[model samples]
Target: MVELNVLVADLRAESAEIDALVGGLSADDWATPTPAAGWTVAHQVAHLAWTDRQALLAINDEAAFRAELAAITVPPERMDELVDAAAAEGAAQPPAELLAGWRRGRDDLAEILERAPDDTKLPWYGPPMSAASMVTARLMETWAHGYDIADALGVLREPTARLRHVAHIAVRTRDFAYLVRGEQPPAEQFRVELTGPDGEVWTWGPADADQRVTGPALDLCLLATQRINRADTALVTAGPDADAWLDIAQAFAGPPGDGRDAGSRERERRTPA
Candidate 1:
């Protein structure tokens, strides 16, 4: 298991990376739409900021978090509506205000996590998570939403070792992915082997597992985060179950996502005369 401090440090770094990306954006730039259907750059940042606030509540005041959760009267199936509503409310703020809130919220969350006990279990939308696991989840969201912001800005970010955290959560949530979709995961475990940016192989599951997914680490991370469609990735699968898993993989909690459409990246990259 990774030390809690290390995970918190990585989470801080990941948040900083996204902060730099939006720190200089013009107000107009904040309105630029990203690949997430109706979400703009502002919406992406707002979502991250809102989620950070939720994380703080979970950590510093569990009763408040529970009360907040209980106050939500939406049916489980429509829970995403609340998520979208929160982002919309935050995005409605002035860009400078939104950015400042995000900065303050994330920084405060990081400080709280750093002081949290290693065995601390935080309540979340999904399952309760250890302090380390919560930080990992936050890092995963920062990277995933940062991709949306980068895409909206027409910038390409180089993959880094931080992706290992995202990929690890994705692999660990394989069963959760299926469960959320009203499906049962295969009883057999699937081996996932990814080639990282530094050429290191990051792997999970039994070495002798018949079901296997092999691909560039970036592709797996993007696919798991639903930032890229399976057809747009170089991921390879050796078993029927493995192939099926790739189609519905998601690293985040909540309802199943409608992943990016095939060829969306190609379309975005096209230079029209």
Candidate 2:
């Protein structure tokens, strides 16, 4: 098992950075098109805020929390108008307001984490989550939504070093593989090696195990989080479960997202060989 304290600290730091990067963005950049189909940069940010609000409810009020989920699962026909409204509401506020609220939300989350005693049962996507899993999910969201905004703005955002939380999530999503294929990992360990930003690298599990995945952290995170596809991306997976695992990698809460369309690869070609 991974260390909970280290994972949470990494999440908090990355979340702070994501807040700073987005805070400095131009208005037009925030409204640009993202890898998320039909979602603008504002929509991506709003989704992060919206997800945080849900996680807050999970830790605070269970009844209120479960009831509130319909809002996310149900696809609204008026998504464009709703996103426009959220952006208008968020953008209209002064930069200080956005920063203050974002900071408050992150702080509140961190506080909840601090209060957990490692034995605490937290609400999670599949089954109850340890406090560490919850924090990892938070970090994954920070990296993911940050990228949507960064890519849309035509600037680079590097969360490669901050991706152990996400890489952890990906490796643990083995059950999703059972859903895709009928079998699961054969009672053996797997290894994951990711090359992070600025020469930093992250490796998880044991090498020379039943399964191993190695790649640039950016591409691995993108593939594991379902933000990109295996066919076009540069990630390499070796072992019995690799191909099946890659077919349906999910690292977040809620229903499986369609992600990038299969036949029509958009960002992969432009991502360099």
Candidate 3:
């Protein structure tokens, strides 16, 4: 298992990368819509800032966090409305203000996590997570949302080794993915073998398992996060369970996402002006 400090460092790095992307954007750029329907670049950063604050509350003040949770009176089905409401509220701030708030919140969360006990468990919308696990989750979100912002700007970010964290979480959350969708995961274990950015192979599960997923690590991470449609990825799967999981795979918490259309990006690229 990776140590807490190492994960913390990676989280900081991931946040910094996204920070650099938005730090100098013009006000108009902030209003540009991202791939996530109805969300602008401002909405992406605002959501990150808002979520960072929630993490801080969970880590530093349990009672306050519980109170905040209790204040939410929305029905379970409409929880997404609450999330969108928060993002919209935050996105309304001036671009400079939004950027500053995001920087502060993410930095504070990282500092607190660094000092937290190794066995510390933090309350989250999903299951309680260890400090390390929490940092990993944050890194995954930072990268995924960052992708949305980049896509909106027509910028292509080079894949890096940091993607390993995203891939690991996607694999570990396989069961959660199914559970959130009101289905039981297959009992049998499936092997996952992915080629990383630098050609390193990351593997999980029994090698001889009948169910297997094999592909580039970047594609798997993008697929798991629902950033790229499965049809646009190079992932190859064997066995019925493996094939099915790819269709519905999601690494993040909350409602099942309406993933990107298979050829939407391609169509966008090929359309005549």
Best by TM-score: 1
Tens-digit lDDT track of model 1 for 113-159: 89988778899987799888989999999999998888878777777
- What are the RMSD figures for all models against the true structure? 2.4, 4.9, 2.7
Worst 10 contiguous positions by lDDT, candidate 2: 264-273
Clashing pairs in 1: none
List ranges where model 1 is wrong by over 4 Å: 267-273
Summarize candidate 2's per-residue lDDT along 96-146 as a digit string, tens digits. 566567677778878888678979887644578778878888888788777
Candidate 3: misplaced stretches above 4 Å?
A: 264-273
Computed on alpha carbons, the lDDT of every model, listed in order, comes to: 0.90, 0.68, 0.90
Task: For candidate 2, report its TM-score.
Answer: 0.76
Q: Give the C-alpha lDDT of model 1.
A: 0.90
TM-score of each: 0.96, 0.76, 0.95
Candidate 1, residue 60: CA error in Å? 1.3
The Cα error of candidate 1 at residue 21, in Å, is 1.2
Candidate 1's clash total is 0
lDDT of 3 by residue, 39-97 (tens): 99999999999999999999889989988888989866578898999999999999999
Indicate the TM-score of model 1: 0.96
Backbone N/Cα/C clashes per model: 0, 0, 0
